[model samples]
Target: MNWILLIIAGLFEVGFATCLGKAKENSGNNAIMWYLGFLFCLTISMVLLVKVSKELPIGTAYAVWTGIGAVGSVVVGIFVFKEPATFWRVFFLSTLILSIVGLKFVSK
Candidate 1:
């Protein structure tokens, strides 16, 4: 359950990052809306992180959290934002995915 919350929290971290990107790409009311989304997602992500950290080891949880966010944001950057998906970029992301999975297995 805690792990699930942590994953959700990590996803919200992606949400905030996406919102920031969208905000940067817009202006006027549209930018304001994206900024509001960023704040909302950031709040929820932090709350869930705090809740899950109580049950999980802090170091493991934090690493996993950031790992998920990094991986997700990169994927979003490639897909949604049309960022380049170079070979080395994908290779590193694969490693990051493996490490996140490994952490889940090694933890708790």
Candidate 2:
């Protein structure tokens, strides 16, 4: 299903983003591996998202894809990268999630 592909793409988005951050932090051979892996995943995910977008409304597809990726990456950044997890940051993240859900329903 297109929606399934969309979700997978979102997951890949998170994967690529996390990998990119890791690549930035490391040096030497490990950094190269992470960078290349990130690029590969990002490219594949974008292609899949484009395919799904052909059959779905652009607004809906893009919103869901980006929303999932943004939220997922931020969570990973906080837990894995030990980025700040302030109360306001969490509140804004929740708002983003709610907006995505609202958009999904309204678009449907």
Candidate 3:
């Protein structure tokens, strides 16, 4: 259950990152809306992180959370934002995903 929450938190981290990216591409009201979304997602992500950290090791939780966010943001960049999906970029992303899964297994 806690791990599930942690994953959701990581997803919200991606939400905030995506919101910031969108904000950068807009102006006025649209930018403001994106910023608001950023704030909302950031708040939820932090709250869940704090909650899960109490049960899981801080180091493992943080690393997994960050890994998920990094991997998710990169995928979003490639798909939604149309960023380049170079060979090295994809290679590292696969490694990050493996590391995240490894952490989950090794962690208590």
Candidate 2 overall lDDT versus native: 0.93
Clashes of each: 0, 0, 0
The lDDT ranking, best first, is 1, 3, 2
> For model 1, how does the per-residue alpha-carbon lDDT over 14-86 read when each residue is reduced to its tens digit?
9999999999999999999999999999999999999999999999999999999999999999999999999
Among all windows of ten consecutive residues in candidate 1, which has the lowest summed lDDT? Answer: 58-67
Q: Any idea what lDDT model 1 has?
A: 0.98
Per-residue accuracy of model 3 over 1-108 as CA lDDT, tens digit each: 999999999999999999999999999999999999999999999999999999999999999999999999999999999999999999999999999999999998
TM of each candidate vs. truth: 0.99, 0.93, 0.99
Tens digit per residue, CA lDDT, model 2, 1-108: 888898899999999999999999999999999999999989988998999999989989999999989999999999999999999999999999998788767864
- In model 3, where is the ten-residue run with the lowest total lDDT? 99-108
With candidate 1 superimposed using the best TM-score fit, by how many Å does residue 42's alpha carbon deviate from the native? 0.1
Q: List the residue pairs that clash in candidate 1.
A: none
List per-candidate RMSD values in Å.
0.4, 1.1, 0.4
